[model samples]
Target: MESLKNNFATKTAILVDGGFYRRRAQAVFGDQTAEERAAELANYCMRHLNFHGESSNLYRIFYYDCAPSSKRVYHPFLKKQVDLGKSDLFEWTTLFFNELKKKRKFALRLGKLAEEQAHYTLRPQIVKKLCNGSIQFSDLQEDDFCLQIDQKGVDMKIGLDIASMAYKHQVDQIVLISGDSDFVSAAKLAQREGIDFVLDPLGAPIKPDLFEHIDGLRTCNKAYTAHTQK
Candidate 1:
């Protein structure tokens, strides 16, 4: 047992915030199916080591997200009522969930989407136009309306895993692919435990305070277009 413990090599773990990564990927790589997105994720994690000419001793990849909510709402573009649970968005989210389950080194951590009381609000640009008298209230269209859903428990699960990795010495490095600062405190704790903490903003601008908490910032693949086209 002692020899086995001593022989354990330093390993790297990747934690991704699925929603953040997906939005950025859609902008950078255009629309992609869940399988393509998963491949991109693994490519990003491996790129970290390849950049510095190191071999991969990947511990695992952790993905955190909330399942799509089952709620009915007005569809602006379609100009009709629809069930969010039955929308294409929901179906795609489920496909993404299932694809992750098939990967050997991937861990899918699910949370919940909380639907709040519905409220009517115009788009910010539309509101500005209305205020400027460029558009009248009577000119408002059904397409201008939008619905919002809040995700819960994702960050908590992420923080708990970070703490677990640090306390249990499960990994020597952590690569977090998230832009939110909610993980700053957890990142600090990991650093205090002598683990290297790296942040992959995936081309997003990060706040200065968040910059201070991480050992470095890196994006595994910058040529997002190349990956998507193939």
Candidate 2:
């Protein structure tokens, strides 16, 4: 019994939805370089350990994201083909992934961007304006459209990993860093297997239904932490 008590500290595995994290980080923490972002991610995951308890140990951090599409797509407004591989975003993402690879106990799970379906779509605001007749189609500019691409295999990878970890007892707890509710099934499975499932939405509001699936709600971001402390 003493041996079991001694090992009672939680073993936690962190799973990050890379796209959701990047968007939230930019909104809450502002922009940072690839190296800085990678460091921030590592620090953020470590914060979860402290939250659990001083005795808690980190198992690993799994980051799921799709590689940026490098395909050239023709822009109707620009009337030209743009090579996405030459864009700053592509370069930044590449650097970011490389930086993540260097972090200890970090695993990069890469999915694929649906290149064939990639195309430019109007921004939401622009679409709204057009629909409301506040702006005419002739007033549109190239900047109004952004590339749209479907991410493949990222969610599946996250779910499979969660289920695998739960069944294998790789960790006593799982902390998922994502705002999407698509993980509900996996979270439920983990809980059924006696794994503690926690969600860190980085301060984003989650659906009320999501509350039932998680063992706890916690956000480790600097802004959220500061707000809570006050």
Candidate 3:
């Protein structure tokens, strides 16, 4: 029993915040097709297994995200209603999810977008430019506004899975890919249960307090490293 315990490989589980990953990936790795992005995701996760060399075995990769809202909404700038279902984001997201489903050992957890509360909001930088008088109201473009929708059940699902994995001893390590600090509580629970909780922010800056909750900080892929250096 002692030898078996000592010789066993370290099992690892990777949890990705899909929305955060997509935004960061687009910024760091440039744009790619859905199939290419899915392959990139798988390759990125494989890099984590190398942290333990030949002693690490992947248990699974959990991706949390919300399905795009297909509702029609009024575009204040365009003076018309826009069908989000026909938008590029909706199509791309659907294709991305389908690609992810085909990857081995990938578990896709989907949450719903709060369509009822969805509204168009100007992008932050655009708002800043307007405030500084660098851009006039007449110069505003339709593309400057984005649909803001809250994601329901994603964080709850992620937390529940982390707790379950920790309690069930399903994995020795839990690596979260997110820049959000909301996962601190879940990280704490995993650490208390003896799981090594790691965070990979994909070159995004995190809050200083987040350091207290994680076991280590690592960005496994070379793309993230190159982006950070720049």
Q: Per-residue alpha-carbon lDDT of model 3 for 1-230, expressed as tens digits? A: 97786577889999999999999999978999988999999999888887633357899999999988899998899988899999998899899999999999999999988999988999999999999999999999988998888999999999999999999999999989998888989999999999998899987888877778898887876655643320
Global Cα lDDT for candidate 1: 0.79
* Candidate 2: residue 203 lDDT (0-100): 90
RMSD of each: 5.6, 2.7, 3.1
Per-candidate local distance difference test: 0.79, 0.90, 0.89
lDDT of candidate 2 over 1-230, digit per residue (tens): 97786667889999999999999999988999999999999998888887834357899999999988789998878989999999999999999999999999999999999999888889999999999999999999888999989999999999999999999999999999998989999999999999989898899888877777888888876557632211
**C-alpha RMSD (angstroms) for model 3:** 3.1
Q: What is the Cα-based lDDT of residue 120 in candidate 1?
A: 39
Sorted on TM-score, best first, the list reads: 2, 3, 1
Worst 10 residues of 1 by lDDT: 221-230
Q: Note the clash tally of each candidate.
A: 0, 0, 0
lDDT of 3: 0.89
Provide the global lDDT of candidate 2 against the true structure.
0.90
